[model samples]
Target: MAAFLGMRGTGDWTDSDMRPKNWRQGVLWQYPNGDAPLTAMLSMMSEKKVDDAQYYWWTQGIPAQGGTVATLNDTTALADDFTTGAVAGQTIYAKVALAVAKHFRPGHQAMLRDASDYGVDTRGLVTAVVHNGASSYVAVKLIEDENTGTGTNLTDCDNILVTGSMNAEGAAMPSAIAYD
Candidate 1:
């Protein structure tokens, strides 16, 4: 009774083998092509690194232009804010607005915005199938406590769906993603 094998190939959770070979968008989470049930996109459960984008900035991911949301992250965004580009580091699909799905318990620290998967954003640990481009989309490595000394600051048109940080196997599973 323990042989699920879902993502089809399991290679980076499928979806055409994940991606990120040369696209730009540091954070991403799309899962839902077939079965669904994989959540989590950034680490969280007790480490308390829950940040939100309300006043921080950085952007640049224009292969076809679908990675907008820039104010300073770098790449000079402003083409009506990208819409769906492709290669520079791979993986860029934004449009979020979440408010549920919380089971964090691996490292404690989660978030999602403008990562419109529809289901209200943020599911469980979508597991990590990722990377970034030369600071890919300009620095997006905020781990914890920033500006207010507690962690979380991704302001300026929030955009998330980066499900890439899952390794749960002992209790708290439902992944993560709990915003409001």
Candidate 2:
């Protein structure tokens, strides 16, 4: 079997939807040889990017695989990768805090932006989010050159509560709301 990556959510354990309490202790990946393999996970602990212990494990112990296995948990990085056109299999897991919806504007062509940096912008085929007055919604879209001009507006939900790692198919962004 191929080596599969293991992930354990490290969030508020007291919360009703909290995941595992320990992310690394029980987190593991089965390898051909029982030899313990290094692991890495990423998240935005605060305003800054947060990478799990695996980052140090790989950087210091084993070399990272060639693929861009990005844990999209970082909002800023997610936008950046998507803007540059994320690879077909580039892994990304993130937490979205707003309404996750799909958008398809016939004549309106927009691109994903780096919302993490607050002001930095990105240009991609998909529109990550659509700003509305004082609120924002996670506006995701599929803009594959091969799938364009299909004339179908693809949207799913109006919002998403705290959830686990999200795998972006086309262009998706994690929306944030201020609690002032």
Candidate 3:
């Protein structure tokens, strides 16, 4: 998978100086592994100049070989697991098995949920990651609470699914993939 910053223009010439000033900038992704390319314009650079761009890329599923959900090492009651609760704007840490730690990258979106109950889930953005011997501790900033009640006592939640990622203009390009 790879992403590129691009612009659209009319009557464009081979010379870079001839590029249109009104041209809009956008981001494009190519999934070489077997998926259609995805594209979205930057809100600040949109034609209408509206700040409404909401772009995200779905994360690849857990490797079929041997990957499992992340486990919660602490509880919210003791201020250990999910330190500041599971509400929006809170950063929480979870223990991810090393086999799948590579999927949790900074700026990536993650989904936390109770494996037994799919209805209870929390959405967050990955902010930091630390790989320790056999597992990794991923720090995610809560963005939305799907159905978590009062966001209390969430020790039963043992799954951190890397759903997708949201990107904004000016952010650094993905380093894991080559860029054009």
Candidate 4:
């Protein structure tokens, strides 16, 4: 038998101290926290190579507010929409990260949407995460095609990104889950 120590910052995978002796030695997966606004926020910085809000649009995260737990440790159903408060007219969805305990079904497409329920044009990859203080599972809608292209639908998403760390930090893992 082998020992697999679980740590944080494995880059969307279970942090394990031991190496995988075989194909299934350890379980590593991506956990969603929320649709991070970093992309949109950075786009505003004139110093950086930024793009339009549409390129940073992502529909995958919990609402910044109003996440109440009905029971102790019960899986909470959560959702979030973009706002102009922080990033001008552009808005980004919040979501939790995927986890090792679960596997994101491959080849899934999420229809991206906005507050108006209209499909908008976007570019680049969306970084999702698991929000703070939640169970392993999150709400996700699988996509039939990966052809998100330059303008994927916002209404649909594969998974709602949630907080990454299992700890109380409630943010992405500061360091690699398991560094060499």
- Candidate with best lDDT: 3
**Which of the predicted structures, 2 or 4, would earn the higher TM-score when compared with the native?**
4
Model 1 gets an lDDT of: 0.30
* Steric clash count of candidate 2: 5
Candidate 3 collision pairs: none
Residue 49 CA error for candidate 2 (Å)?
33
Put down candidate 3 lDDT per residue, 1-180, tens digits, no spaces: 122334343422355563333322222222222233232333223455436566444455534321355555443222354433456786677776765566667777787777677766778887876767455777777797546464434555667777777667788885462112
* Model 1 misplaced regions, further than 4 Å: 1-143, 147-153, 175-180
For model 4, the stretches where C-alpha displacement exceeds 4 angstroms are 1-91, 97-131, 135-152, 160-174
Please, what are the lDDT tens digits per residue for candidate 4 over residues 1-180? 222332323232244653432212211211122132343223223453336533332345433321221221112344334222221223233343333213222121222333232334222122233434334322332222222343544434322322222323465444323212
Per-residue error for 157 in candidate 2, Å, reads 9.7
Off by over 4 Å in 2: 1-36, 39-97, 101-125, 131-142, 145-180
lDDT of 1 by residue, 1-180 (tens): 112334332234335655532112122233333233332222111234237534333554423212343322222231234332112332222222112112222333233333333322222222221123322232232342222222222332254333445444575664443433
lDDT of 1 at 18: 52
Better of 1 and 3 by TM-score: 3
Clashes of 1: 45
Instruction: Flag clash pairs in model 2.
Output: 39-54, 40-54, 72-93, 94-166, 99-159
TM-score of each: 0.18, 0.18, 0.52, 0.20
